[model samples]
Structures are given as structure tokens and as C-alpha cells.
Target: MPSQYRPQLLGWIDDLDKGTNYLSGADDRLLYANDNYCAFLRKTSSDQIFYLCISFICIIGSLFLIPSLIYSLPSCNNKAIYFLLLAGLVCSILILYVMIPELYQNLFTRKGCPIIFNRKTNKVYINESY
Candidate 1:
């Protein structure tokens, strides 16, 4: 049997793989799933997955902006912009907290292999160990 940490870490990796599969396989449906799908589906539901993906993208983008924002803060001389950046950072942190768990659950709750998609090549792979 795997150690506690090993399973948890593997679960996270599986979730990432499953998330990638969802993104590439059913792109349109996942993107435009209606209220029914969002409300009813468990684990890798459209909204949760989409939010997780968006949160990651936003976090990466925010990291790039952090340095510039910090450097310009003093010269900005504008309280509003500073407040906006602070608010954005807080929101991004919150999103990360919410989405990461959901992503992990979505990936590891199932018994089958973790599914991954290569968007560039539009190919799918199943990772059984996960």
C-alpha cells in the first residue's frame, strides 16, 4: 500500500490528468453546460472544472503582474489601482483554495485510470496508476 502522502499526491496528479481530458475531449459541452449539468454532475462537473482551470490561468497571469505592480505601487500615486490589485490578489488566493480541492476530488474519486488530453495534438491518454 502507498503512504498517506503518496496517495494524496497521486490523487492531485490524477485530478490534473482528468481535468486535462475534460478540457480537450468535450470542450464545447464542458464550456457551455447548462444549469442542469452544473447542478447535477458530481466531481468533475462543468462549473467546478471550469472554475479550477480559470483559477490556475488567472494565478499564472497574476504572478507575472505581481512584480510590475509592486514596482509601480509607489510611483502609481493612485490608491484606487493599488486597492484593485490587492483585491485581485485576494480573490485569486480564494479561488485557488476552492478549486484545488475540487480538482483533486474530481481526479481521484474514481477507480479507473486518469485521463489526460493533449490539446495541441488532440490526443487522449489514460494513466492507470493514478
Candidate 2:
């Protein structure tokens, strides 16, 4: 039979004696109480900042371009404005979708299968049974 494997949480240390996992940092914070590796694969502060910045730019561009497009509707023959308008609306919608906390959590947090430690075997396994 083929061996089964589970994904081990990276950058963490487990203590069977203490019955707790330690997360890396200056203070070495304790892992949160969860069977699943909640501490793994989190977005960094820099990533959050970048996402916010890009989202802001997209939103601002949409706000400006949309109004301009609406105001210029009398010139329906100008396909360029309509194209710009469509682009702006699409960008804004995409930004909003990305910013949605529920959607982000569902997509990034819940959907991933990560590696975790098998304490009994003293070996690591990739959690493919997600």
C-alpha cells in the first residue's frame, strides 16, 4: 500500500511535553488553539499594505473614469470612452471582491491543504485530506 502523507506547518515548533506549538518571532508567540494550522501561510504586513495601495488606486481610477463616462454619454459614437468606462468598472469590481474579508478567508484560509507534523511518527506529512 502507498503511504499516506500530511502537510506539516512550516516555521513552527511543537512541544509534546508542553502540548503546544510555538510560533516564531522575537517573543516566540504561542500557536492559537486550533487543530488546523491557523498560524501558517498568513499574509504578511507588507502584502496587506500592497493590496490596500493597489485597491485604492483601482477604486480612485474607477470613481473618476465612471463619472466622466456618464457625463460624456451624449457622444455615444466615441467608443473609446465606453471602453474606458468598462475597464474602470471591471477594475473597481475586482478590487472590491479582493477586499471582501469573507471571500478572502474562504479562498485563502479555508481552501489550502498544508503540511503538519505527525507527533506519533515523529515525521512531517502534507495534509492532502482537506
Candidate 3:
């Protein structure tokens, strides 16, 4: 293929492998179905995943700290520190028990992917098709 056509040819091949995308294959009805595009259905979905991971760490850390907190309470002789540690443990437990399920529902229960088209600039973007 000519050098100028090489990029377009490669793009076509890539689109074919990707199955369906707004920028390429599968016709109008299937334009919204692409693995890469579908993975990122919501713009903030990735951010939410990151937050969930961080929250998991917080829960684990608090669990491990409970023993240390109890060990320190006698030596430190501070009721406030003990209560604060207890509160942290409770809050972390609440987040795990409550927020984790909610996050799963909100993040994973999306119905379908959406293909976004910009009218003025004629640009296209894909979102979760849920």
C-alpha cells in the first residue's frame, strides 16, 4: 500500500479487530459496541474504581490498627485516643459494608453504552452503553 494509505489501512484493520466503534466498523446500529469504548462507559468510572481501591486500603489498615490501638491505650492513658481509634474502625467498617455494595451497584449496573457525537465540530466519543 502507498504510504498515505497505510495509516487508513491499519486503522481499518484495527477497527475490524475491535468489532464495532463510532469511528469505524459494524454499521450505525452497532457503532456503540466496542470493547475499549465500553470499558470506559462513564468518564468518572475509572476514578470511582480508584477511590474504591483506596477505600479498601483504608479498611484493611484500620483493621490492622485496632490491635495496636488497644495496645497503646494502657501506656498512653488517653481515652480520647482510644475513642478516636474505635471511631475510625467503625467508619471503615461502615464504608466497607455500605459503600462497597453501593459502588458495585452504581458502577457496574449501567444499562448500555452511549456514543456521543459533537454536532458543531462533528466529533464522536463513546460512553458505557448500559
Best by lDDT: 3
Tens digits of per-residue lDDT for model 2 on 1-130? Answer: 4335333333343432244533334122233324433323233344545665665665566566656756665666768877876676566666556555433433344323334444455565554322
Runs in model 2 deviating more than 4 A are 1-38, 78-130
- Of the pair 1 and 2, which is ahead by lDDT? 1
Off-target runs (Cα >4 Å) in candidate 3 are 1-40, 43-45, 66-76, 102-130
- Pitting candidate 1 against candidate 2, the one with the higher TM-score is 2
lDDT of 3 at 71: 67
Model 1 agreement with the true structure over 31-56: per-residue lDDT tens digits: 22221211111234555567557756
| TM-scores, all models, native as reference | 0.37, 0.40, 0.35
Candidate 1: residue 34 lDDT (0-100): 27
What does candidate 3's lDDT look like per residue over 1-130, in tens digits? Answer: 3223112333433544544543333232232322222222332445556756776675567567656766665675578877787786566566557655544544564432444444346456765433
> Against the true structure, candidate 1 has what lDDT?
0.48
